[model samples]
Target chain A: MVEQHIASAFDRDLEAIQAQIMKMGGLVEAAIMDAARALETRDEELAQQVRQGDKAIDGLEELINEEAARVIAIRAPAAVDLRLVLSVMKISGNLERIGDYAKNIAKRTAVLAQGPNVSESAAAMRRMAREVELMLKDALDSYIQRDVELAQDVIARDRDVDQMYNALFREFLTFMMEDPRNITPCMHLHFIAKNVERMGDHVTSIAEQVVYLVTGDKPEDDRQKADTTSSVPQEV
Target chain B: MVEQHIASAFDRDLEAIQAQIMKMGGLVEAAIMDAARALETRDEELAQQVRQGDKAIDGLEELINEEAARVIAIRAPAAVDLRLVLSVMKISGNLERIGDYAKNIAKRTAVLAQGPNVSESAAAMRRMAREVELMLKDALDSYIQRDVELAQDVIARDRDVDQMYNALFREFLTFMMEDPRNITPCMHLHFIAKNVERMGDHVTSIAEQVVYLVTGDKPEDDRQKADTTSSVPQEV
Candidate 1:
């Protein structure tokens, strides 16, 4: 009976840790969205808010890692439990990195806000940002619900973001070519697209972590071996 | 007497592993060069050489990891010793990834070879490839020699590569604008520049690994607080 109580308490602690991870994910997703919105609307203050939240993301990453260490030392989790802690560590790291990239985009947004006539370029970027935001939300949802199918959807959706990014890259390049005066803003747009593409990669990484958490196996092999002829799909 | 024998044998094994790492670095560097050369010269045979060498690089990475695991299990190394083994594992992973990226470039070269004329676009890509090859060489040199100065040079030189990439990106944009027919080749050029940039990043990761190996502390604080500018320098 005492042992059951002890195990229950440890499980509760792990649940708390998981909840914190979800909270951090929510914060990061909001930061990504705000940064994107800031870029779209040229809202310098919102961009600054996203930039400032980076420290909080970093703090949460370190905090979760420390908690995980403590749990491992005390509970000595095995198999699935071991996988869960490891996934959390890696997932949180990826999330923190996503936060960093979002901060970078926000910084670039702040710079762009200082300029004029960003609406056209910003609209194109908004399309990319909205898709990436959706992926991030779904990936975290997959994690929270332990839904492998949702995670698979996130993985499949990454190629769409990749294709969108390629198209946007060409569009930005056209803007730069049309006028060298647009170089600075084009560079900022390029960075935004790059960050969003990386955000997709991070979301894919998170989805991979979810698979490991649920299945105890890596799914990378299947994806890596995908046919080379298959171009990433396009969406309206 | 028995303890002394075991200690001497362990030290000998450790030295052997170190030698193997250096040798693996040489192989990786060669692969990067050959892959890039194959692209520049359109030498399908050299590209084939890189393809054939992929197995060797994969084997080396596995060997390094296995040896590190064995050492950790048998010797129970702590502190700097622990850091050294960990560094070995990470550096080996970095080298393996470098090899994969090199292989990717080689494969792209194969595709480009299938095309006629290949254009000045290919030339631009070749230049980026050469820069990446140089960075790979310098990074590994720093790792093998433990020359922080060499690593610092690499860190600094990465910026030059970045600026060149940005310039090339601008140039490619113009090419694509002049003719949308040029988009595919331009896409290839962009991939080359990106691969080069990532090669620099891997080298820096190696540099960081070396620092951790020698210092037993990751330079995380330096990274987070220091110049968060473009990862590479911005010199042409």
Candidate 2:
């Protein structure tokens, strides 16, 4: 009877932690979209809000971790239950990192708001961030539903984000080569794009965690990176 | 008698995991130094070695995590022992990330080796990398010794790394403004500097984990960031 009671309590604890994960995921997705929108509209106020909102996301991660540790200490969960707790810790860490990238993008957006607009780059970055936000939404859904196929789909979509970042990178280089005045703004835009690309990578990591949670095995590390700016010869 | 045997087994498991952590730390330290030397000396072969060597570091992290999970499951360590296991998982994650940064520096080094030299930037980056390497060594030492003072010292030194990054950012901007030819090379060098700066951040995180492991509380998040490039006015 006591064993059954402890198991029920563990189930309740797991459910509560999962709920927190979803809430944190929701905040990160909003941060991504709002930061991108701020850059697109040059809305410094929106950018400031995104920056401030990250504190809540960070706090949620800490709360989730503490809760996970308490459950582990008190319940002594075994096998699959233990794996679930560990995966929750990792997913929250990924979410916190994604929030940080959003904060970085907002910081750069504030700086770029003072400079001249780099043509169409902000719009391009918004599209990229939009894709990442969708991936994160699906990634979270997969975790809640324990749907491996949906998580795999999210992993596959990160390549598109990388490709978008590479395009922005080359475009920024061309702009800088054309005009010295464009250099500073384009550099800032380039980093914002890079930050968004990293967001996709972290989203992919969350999806991978979902796969591990379901299968009890890590997915193969065969995801080919599509960001080639680091490798291409400096012909520009 | 049986309980004592299990306790000794758990101790053995913990010792093996810590040994792996030390080995991983050594590899990461070598990677940082090798990647920096490759950039400073324009040695493509050395850079390639650092890139390939990261696989070993990554493999060790995976191994450490598996062992940690096993220990947690079989031993079901509670309280302080459980915290030690959890901290090992997080520290390995940080070390894996630092290795990735070193690989990134090497990738950029291979590209920059083909281009005309940006004056003194590579050497300056080497100096920055050296500081992070030293900080990491101290961080790992503190982890093994459970020395909170040394960990705190490592945390404090990250500020120097950030200040170095800011100086490099401004210098890169000046070079780009002076000659368009310096734009591409300076951008690559700038990223290498930023990567090293991020390495410092990760080392600080490892040190923070050390503090947490020894003391049952998280250190205050009051560490001020000295990297002002993202926020500074775009006058350059």
Candidate 3:
């Protein structure tokens, strides 16, 4: 009976730690959306919100690290638990980096907002952002539920994001070449596309982390094959 | 006496691991230099040589990872020893990624060899490549020697690499716009510049790992501030 209680207590702590990760994920997901939305609507206030959330993400990372250390110190978790904590640590770093990228996008977006949005490319950019936002959401869901198939689907979708970003980049280049006046805002838009592409990468990182959580193999090798061999169509 | 023997063995293993890291660092440093030289001279065979070294880098990373795991399982080291192993595991990944970037630059450089040198921005690009190569060498030295000042210097120098890349990028964009024939090679050159920039980033990552090895506290944030605030000029 005592052993059962101890096991149950350990389970509870693991669940709590997982819950904290989910909370941070939720906040970061929102930050990505809000950051992009700020860019689209020129809402500096929303960009401010995204910047403010960065510290919370940092605090959540600290909490997760400390709690994982305590669990390892106290419970001496075995293989599966050990893998889970390790995945959480690695995935949390990716998430924090995604947050930083979101902040970077917002800062540049704010500067871009000062200009006229007369170009036709902004509409295509909005569509690209929406798709990236959905991918981020689904990737986080897959992580929380440990859904390998969903994670794979997220990986498959990254090609679409990459293609869209490339097209948008080409179009932006054309716009910039037409007039030097378009250079500054066009560069901001270019970075926004790059950030969204990078955000997709972070989601892919999360997907890979989920795979590692399920299986011990690193996903790095598999990704190269998918990148080189897959024939997925562009979405945006 | 028993404690003395175990401590001595532990120290020996650490020295062995450090030696291996240094060995791997030498190869990566050489690959960086050769890749840049190949680009400067358009030497396809030398580029291929850099590409071949990537496999050796992979082997080294695998060896280091296995050694780290074995040490953890057998000796169950604690405190500073554990931190050193952890830092090595992380930094080994950084070094391997740097190797991959060198391979990438070589691949792009190889393609550019078939064509005439980009007439407009080749000088700026050559300068950028040299600066990046030196930064990689200095960063590796910092890691092997645990020279904090040297690491700081590497970080500060990254700003120069970035500035050069930015200038090259703008110049290349103009070339691409002026002549559609230049687009393919210019894009390849752009990727080469980006690869070198990324190499500088990996060096900084290694520097961070070294700082963590020496100080125990995560020095990433402080290093970022010092690199930007101390010596590097701020640019708009």
lDDT of 2 by residue, B102-135 (tens): 9999999999999888789888889999999999
Ranking by DockQ: 2, 3, 1
List the candidate numbers ranked by lDDT, top first.
2, 1, 3
- Cα lDDT tens digits, model 2, A1-236, are 98999999999999999999999999999999999999999999999999899899999999999899888888888889999999999999999999999999899889989987779988889999999999999999999999999999999999999999999988988888898888888778888899999999999999999899998778775468899989867678
Model 2: how far is B19 from its true place, Å? 1.0
Question: Which is the leading candidate under DockQ?
Answer: 2
Residue B197, model 3, lDDT:
74
Clashes of each: 2, 0, 0
lDDT of 2 at A6: 92
* Consecutive 10-residue window with the lowest summed lDDT within model 1 chain A: A227-236
Alpha-carbon lDDT of model 3: 0.72
The CAPRI classification for model 1 reads as incorrect
Candidate 1 C-alpha lDDT tens digits along B71-145: 655665544555566568668878887887788777777766765543565566667667767777777778777
Q: What is the lDDT of residue B12 in candidate 2?
A: 93
Fraction of native contacts in model 2?
Answer: 0.66
Could you tell me the C-alpha RMSD of candidate 1 in Å? 5.8
